[model samples]
Target chain A: MASLKNIVGGELKGYTELLQDARQEALNRMIDQAKQLGANAVVNVRFSTSSVAQGAAELYVYGTAVRLG
Target chain B: MFDSISIVIFGVLFIVGYLAGTINEKRHYKSIKKREEKLLSLPAISMKRLESSDGITKSELVSESVVVSIDYFKRALAILKVLIGGSVGPYESLIDRARREAVLRMKESAPGAAIIINVRVETSTIGNAANSKGAVGSVEALAYGTAVWK
Candidate 1:
């Protein structure tokens, strides 16, 4: 991958988009779970990412579900 | 022995990487400053909770993540720094940009919210080169918080 074109490094746009999409999907799932619990808000949200396999990564998101009056 | 042609090619690539990386970083910083000013009204705080939760009508989770790649020039600088045993200055701006961009996007996602609390920012390196040597890699920054509106 050290070709001449790769010499001048820049933003990996495709990888960026892919990670963003994966994160969004994880967040959406968390939100859905919170909704199922009849919670209107989630606080103290946190995100974690790990490379589970070569060329594969996992995004884990969690938070506290709460009802704001 | 190192071929003269290969050395010349390497030198050219280093120059190109430096020029392009500098320009890209400058443009990104400019954009970041502009957006930060535009979103100045909404504050994202790291406090887990507000002093008074009163009058908070609604709240929801908001987050944004970004992956930024490093240029060959900066990577070379980082390698050099590793040998010298000092701070890697070239990568600082890269991380800063990624973090700021993530936070900005998080704020953008919750436009109507009055404030964001319990904000958290996490970073990690991702890409084929992340674990390998002699290759460029990307950093991922994730920002999250709870946006509340009164």
Candidate 2:
């Protein structure tokens, strides 16, 4: 499986599954962006988050955009 | 009189150097964190959870271990244009070098494998906190790669 990291970091509360859901949400957005850009894979992925802002805040996701088979 | 003047000058230079080094260290730390944050926010090309053993996995069956190390310095540069302070170079290199060594070991152990999926790189602090400036932080890089015969 190819790995990736989102470009932002923030406080995530609740359980692991919830965090995973949020991560998936961000991943889906990233995949959509990649698909639009005609890229198949992303590598050297990293993740980051900002300090906790609010109960609901923004999550930034990014990765090394790549084309894969 | 001349000796006194030289001592004063040396002291001033020392203080200046220390201050400059501290400022640079802070900048480097911020930059590293920023880059990490940016990398983490993006959607992943793919995500999977692997087991030491169990149900079959997705993608192809390529048993390989790939170790990747990210220098907080390089990461800092990528995130922010900050030249890390002096002492950090060696530690960062150490972490990277260790990762490289581990990767090579993986290669040696697992031959005939093009890549190592479910790759995980672990990092730990090497020295005492007093010795390392705040720039010294431990990191572990994990990734899954496909080992295709090339």
Candidate 3:
């Protein structure tokens, strides 16, 4: 797969899919936490991605949970 | 002398990359335009708060990220650009597409939102080629905002 990417030199669809999945997972987890706190909404959202290993990355997401009256 | 077979291989790769890359970019841009038109009514603003929060009963955080890769042909152009020390045109479009796509996805995730406030977009390079020489790298764009609706 790596060799093919070097030759084709186009969008890495597989890697993109992987990252998207990871991001969605992180977002869902954040939402679940907010739900546990009885929050109807979350604001001031933020996200950051960092390479935790040679070939792995970590997607971190956070926001302020709030209940709208 | 450099091997002729390798030169031919390189040429083939370059042509293939160029053809495939152009098609991919055109299709992506077309989809982006259509989606942008469809979502035009939803306003996304960078301001921290709105003048009035009247009737805003719910709010939620929405975010999206996308990773776009460069084709061999464009990477070659960028490498030559490095020597001449000027802006890399190919990379500019790549980042543009990534940002727009990310924002679009963020908006899509909040279908019921009235408006998205405090929107932010950020970008970075990732993958094996990010810090190395002669390999292609991918650009990641993250867009986030708070979606509020009545």
Per prediction, fnat is 0.45, 0.00, 0.36
Clashes of each: 0, 38, 1
In terms of lDDT, the poorest run of 10 residues in model 2 chain B is: B61-70
Cα shift from native, residue B134, model 3 (Å): 6.8
Candidate 3 residue lDDT tens string, B18-98? 988888889889999999999999989999998998999988767777778777777777778878888889889989998
Candidates 1 and 2, the one with greater TM-score: 1
TM-score of candidate 2 against the unseen true structure: 0.29
RMSD of each: 3.2, 15.7, 3.2
lDDT of 2 by residue, B1-150 (tens): 999997886566445534543454455456555654544422222224433434333333221122222332333333332354444553454354434443444334444543355454433321222133332222322222343332
User: In model 3, where do residues sit more than 4 Å from their true spots?
Assistant: A1-11, A24-43, A63-69, B130-136
Model 2 DockQ reads 0.02
Question: Which run of 10 residues does model 3 chain B get worst, by summed lDDT?
Answer: B127-136
Which scores greater on DockQ, model 2 or model 3? 3
| Docking level of model 1 | acceptable
Task: At residue B52, give the lDDT of candidate 3.
Answer: 90
The sequence of per-residue lDDT tens digits that candidate 1 reaches over residues A1-69 is: 323324555556677788889988988999999999999887667789988766688999887899889
iRMS of each prediction: 2.9, 15.6, 2.7
Model 1: what TM-score for its first chain?
0.87
- Which is the better candidate, 1 or 2, if ranked by DockQ? 1
Poorest 10 consecutive residues by lDDT, candidate 3 chain A: A2-11
lDDT by candidate, in order shown: 0.81, 0.39, 0.81
- Number of the top-ranking candidate, with TM-score as the measure: 1
